[model samples]
Target: MEIEVRDLAGLGEWSAASALYRSVFGYVEPEFGVSPRLLAALHENSGSVIGAFDRGELVGFCYGFTAVEDGVIYHYSQAAAVAARAQGAGVGRRLKFAQAEAARRTGARTMRWTFDPYALRNAHFNFAVLGATAIRFLPDYYDDGSSDRVLVSWDLSGHVPAPSRSDEVVAPSDGRWSAPDPPDRVTLRAALIERFRAGGRLVEVTRRGEQAVYKFREADR
Candidate 1:
């Protein structure tokens, strides 16, 4: 498919972006859906909205707004979605790359977002492919009852060190499995959560058998 990805700069693209979001996330409730008006308002303010079109039909979109944490400004990617039929087609990655570039131009040094820590594919992509690191474990982070997530920060500043080696730090043992089925859902292991809260920074992840090993460094605090 000839995919064209560009800024969704006007209200004209909002409905299609919201429709794609609903289709991908399977949101049936109106309150849970993305509002074109809200999206348009975000673009009007200090935010961004990008859409991917396939033959003039919206296939995917990513949206986010500027945020400040610890006095550091960053872009908080609020939502990203691709139609079920268009997933695995490199659409999500492309959108993120574009987002990072756009964010840097706006003087942001990082982009923060969250995703299911139990989602192995997301882990691999966010950590291995995008070079982001998990900073916190947000249990029940949302109201929809599907809230378990790992808050991550992508280093748009391009100065963060490479992920430390897996063997350099203590690995959590709470949620180890004997190589379970691929792509199966699991919860955030309690031991890992403790490690994070105790000033640990996840620097590397490796898969052993059905077990996923995570490495962390003691926080400087």
Candidate 2:
């Protein structure tokens, strides 16, 4: 399926995007739907939103914005949706890759986003396949009372100076990730959680061939 992707406002595909979200998310009343005006505001800001079309049909989309933090500017993805039919064809993955590219073009050092925790599929995509990490787990962060999703922030611009996990897991680990044993010498998950609450944490999961990796450093207790 030939697809075209570009930065566009919510206006151009407002109707179709909404419909796609409703379809994929399976909402009877279309709750938490995005409006064209809201998307336009996001578009006018530092971040550029994108849409994907296949055969002249709106199949997927995403939207978010950039912010200044610790003297560095980065984009944070808010929401992304794809039609059910297009799920297996790599449309969502492509859209995410495109979003990361857009962030790099803007000179941002990172791109962050939140994902539902209970979504097993998302775990494979965000954590394993895409190599994202979870520095913190915010319990009921959304407080929406109806969803079990957690916030998963990612870094798009690997251009930033940071530690490298060059030899932990040996490649081809596409979503076939395994959670390593908790740190043997420490209980630092709380501190990590705190860092996330303060927005000072950005988790990076590296894949080495078929093996996935999660690496971190805490005060050696």
Candidate 3:
């Protein structure tokens, strides 16, 4: 599979990217969907709207914008999605690296994003594959008490270090990537929140026997 990663421009491309985002995430609510107009505006600004193509067909896309926190400028990746057929083909990673390169060119040294804590696959990709570190855990990040997220920061300069020994661990039930049972999910969520509040930063996800364990280390003060 020959995947081409590049910047997306114009309404036609934006529209296609927008539709692909919605389709990949199975988003039906209008409020959850991104508009082509917004994409155009972001592209015009110092924001990144990157897409992965297979023979000119859009297969994956990611978008982010430059943001400042405490006077430190960084890129905040808003969302990224890959077509089901293109997943596991290295398309998502390509889109992210390309996005990081674009942000680096814009004078940003780091990129931040949020992901579901229960998605072990995503955790492995962010921490193990991309070498990102999770600094904060936001319970019900969307204010709906349902969308819990963990905020991660990736060094655009590729200077992230290997994870050290974990001070705490959150092991998934039955070795599953996600907790589908409501009670189990709630328990794991609480565990992660407690660990984060105790000043632990998630550094890696590793397998211990049959379980997938999320490893966290105390953040340097």
Candidate 4:
């Protein structure tokens, strides 16, 4: 599928934007802050938003609003959603690059957002792909019970110029694994989701607690 990024306010774009988010996030009505009018407002002031389309079908989008947090003004490049079908083929990466350019033009130097730490894919994007290092990890930033959030910060000055080799850093390990800590009941095989920002492999112990799941990261072959 072909992917192109466009200004968020373009005709029929908001409908497509909402649909993309719905497909990607699968959240109920209570969770969202977007409406056609709110999206229009986002287009008028502060930072910008963009959508990825394939053959005239909206497949993905990245949006952010301006905010002052911790006494710092930032254009928080909050969230991006891609059609589930378009994942793995680099749609999300392109959407982010487009937003980065858009944010840069608006004089935004840094971007901040929140994401679930358990999503290995996001870990690859924020750290390995975007060259964004975490300033902190919040245990229950969302307080939703499931999927704890981590507050993320990105510097436009240090953006990655090319698609990241996220594959190389986080390779799946052997099957039926366990963390060294026994009482933890969190049986986890090692999956290298990323490496240290300073340069080393970052391995994650996938499942933590009783009722353990199957092998999370096993040998590819």
Candidate 1 wrongly placed segments (more than 4 Å)? 162-188
Cα lDDT of all candidates, in order? 0.77, 0.62, 0.87, 0.60
lDDT for each residue of candidate 3 in 1-221, tens digit (9 for 90 to 100): 78889999888899999999999999999999999999999999999999999999999999999999999899999999999999999998888899899889889999999998777788889998999999999988999978889999998886746545567565554544655678878787888888999888988877677566788876765
TM-score of each: 0.85, 0.68, 0.93, 0.69
Residue 176 in model 3: lDDT: 44
Task: Indicate which candidate wins on lDDT.
Answer: 3
Better of 2 and 3 by lDDT: 3
lDDT of 1 by residue, 1-221 (tens): 77888889666789888888887888898988988998888787778788888898888899999899778889999889988878899988989988887788778999999987655677777888898888898877986676677888899877667444333322223243312433233433566677788877775666754467667765534
Better of 1 and 4 by lDDT: 1
Q: How would you encode candidate 4's per-residue C-alpha lDDT over 1-221 as one tens digit per residue?
A: 87788887854788768766776778677556456566677888876678888888888888888878767677877678888788888988888777777777777777777765445556656666776544444555666654445555677887433433332222222223222243332222122122222232222323334222221222112
What are the per-residue Cα lDDT tens digits for candidate 2 across 1-221?
88887777546576666667667777786456766777777777767578788998888888778876778887888788888777788888888888888888778856777665333466668866776665456655668753333455566644333554322212223344232233410233344345445544334444555444434433112
Q: Cα deviation of 105 in candidate 4 (Å)? A: 2.0
Return the candidate ranking by TM-score, descending. 3, 1, 4, 2
Residue 49 lDDT, candidate 2, scale 0-100: 72
Off by over 4 Å in 3: 161-165, 174-178
* Worst-scoring 10-residue span by lDDT in model 1: 165-174
Positional deviation of residue 65's Cα in model 3 after best superposition, in angstroms: 0.4
Root-mean-square deviation of every model:
4.0, 6.6, 1.8, 8.6
